[model samples]
Target: MDDPQRSLLYRWPTAAKFDRRVPKEKLYEHGTGTPAVREKFVAEVQRITWAFKLAETTINLAGNTAVPEIQIFEIDAKGTNVTEPVLTAIDKAIPFPIIFEINRDDGETRSTRMVAAHKQLGSGAPKIGAYYSTGWQSARTERQSLPTAITLPALYTALLDPLTPMAARPGEDVSEVAARLKAMRKLEREIAALERKLRTETQFNRKVELRRALKTKQAELTMLVER
Candidate 1:
């Protein structure tokens, strides 16, 4: 049985601070004095914060599951529990799948890592007297058996296969809708780029040429959107 409080499989190495120049004695340091480094660091951290916000919906959905566990390792570029403001906000937003660990850098002595390795080798060392499971036994094991999330590609494909809509349209499948949406988004991006270029263009002849190109792109975008 798994402990409810210890379920969230959070893992993060030490935080890497953003420094302008290479430190003489330190791997990374807070950019306190350097304005350029400070600005860059702030921007990068903001970008990461936005990414978490974007994935918030999915994270919330996962949190409601029977054995909920949220992984916060990947999002932390500057180690566990280092940043104050952004992390606090994210923590508040995530009500489910309570955080288990902040710094997972102590893998050298972790028994979970040992169990995972033992399982990979088709050995019964992780558990007592269990052996001879055929063909990639890890995927079939219950969710609570592993400390970390499953990384098998085929298992993921099999799990997500049923989520594919049965009949999206009369003659169209989900993949076609996805492809069409991708193409439409591409055209929209190209149109936006051309418009930005048209704004910066100075020469009269060049502006005229840009206008024609922009018009063509806009027409294509309209067609794609309508389809």
Candidate 2:
């Protein structure tokens, strides 16, 4: 006999991001239950655990017969925050746009974007609606709740501190301040170029740590200009 559920859960359309294929008979039976699509979704997610770094995964039946949410392990920051349920809590997303945060090892946070929704398909296997999504990328992240005060923490190593910011448009007293800034920028360029030239992982990580150390000094300089 054919493993119908697995069939529906794994098959993918030619170019679509997910599996929306469903059997005609089951569509009459449970297609009314929710997305005959989400079941296949979570399975696809399970297949890509390597990319997402997702640990555990669970799919729950929601009241909506067309949209199922997901719970996926996120190894990143927020220490395993419940994922799919968070998506469901949002506007019962259709074209499913999800926004979440990832904690980086360096005490900084990264923002993530995902989608969870329906994919209407032609005749094939059937499954529940899943928390649909593409993937995550590093992007701007603001501090929690306190949205206005800080912007994304700009990435600048202290090495860059000596560089002048806002290169003066005209000869506005190229003061001591300007020269220091120019020199800092030059040093930063040298460091970055050196990093790019290296091929060893050990050396690369070392350079990265060095860059981060400079971040503190860089922050102080920018802060000074702010005042």
Candidate 3:
């Protein structure tokens, strides 16, 4: 397995810094909804800061129409974990794609993790895919320079590559990698279900059938892995 903490953190340029503290109320006002989500924010999130903005103007990279700017938001977490709903709410409220840095303090030590979903802009709303994250590392972990790219969209893809479960194949972009990951996730779930069913089956014929189905799912997963 690759070290996720390696080449994963970037030293953002001072020219692109947007050190604004984003109020939780502002997120709710901008369309992050439901009483449940609001409550989660209150209970689990201590602060939200708009830490940096990567754009053509700030970074000298050309911007794509679909991805004009990338925003980096840092969340000071109140607990060890922040649920998906909390993240989804923030993604929905923000129009642009965002990279989240979640920081937590355990009194003796401070740790940080990176989390984000592949966000796409459609005609009506921004479509967010499953989240990808890195395991927690010390706050003092060494940082790396940003991935080399000529455009914001390309840079976005490069940044997300490290967080994905599978390495991107030659000629594959972020969207393609995301689609493959979704398929892999589906196959994983089906394989688990089949294995569980096989464990308790007593009849010889039923066990045989379950095993056949489980083998098929496992083969499919293997193919995806090889890709």
TM-score top scorer: 3
The clash count of every prediction, one per candidate, is 2, 26, 0
Each model's TM-score?
0.28, 0.19, 0.88
Candidate 2 TM-score versus the reference: 0.19
Candidate 2 Cα deviation (angstroms), residue 91? 4.3
- Model 1 residue 175 CA deviation (Å) reads 0.9
Ranking by TM-score: 3, 1, 2
**Which stretches of candidate 1 lie above 4 Å from their native place?**
1-170
In the range 1-227, model 2's lDDT, one tens digit per residue, is 11112111111112222323223233223333344345433322222111211111221112121212222222233332225533342223222121222223323645343333222212333221333332333445321221221111110111111122433322222233344445555666655665554434466778677667556556655654452
Tens-digit lDDT track of model 1 for 30-104: 212245444333543312321111122332222212123332212323322223333333333333211211221
* Per-residue C-alpha lDDT of model 3 across residues 124-161, encoded as one tens digit per residue: 77888888888788888788889888888888888888
After the best TM-score superposition of candidate 2, give how far the Cα of residue 226 lies from its true spot, in angstroms.
56
Tell me the alpha-carbon RMSD of every candidate: 19.4, 20.9, 2.7
Candidate 2 lDDT score relative to the true structure = 0.30
Off by over 4 Å in 2: 1-82, 91-106, 119-128, 140-227
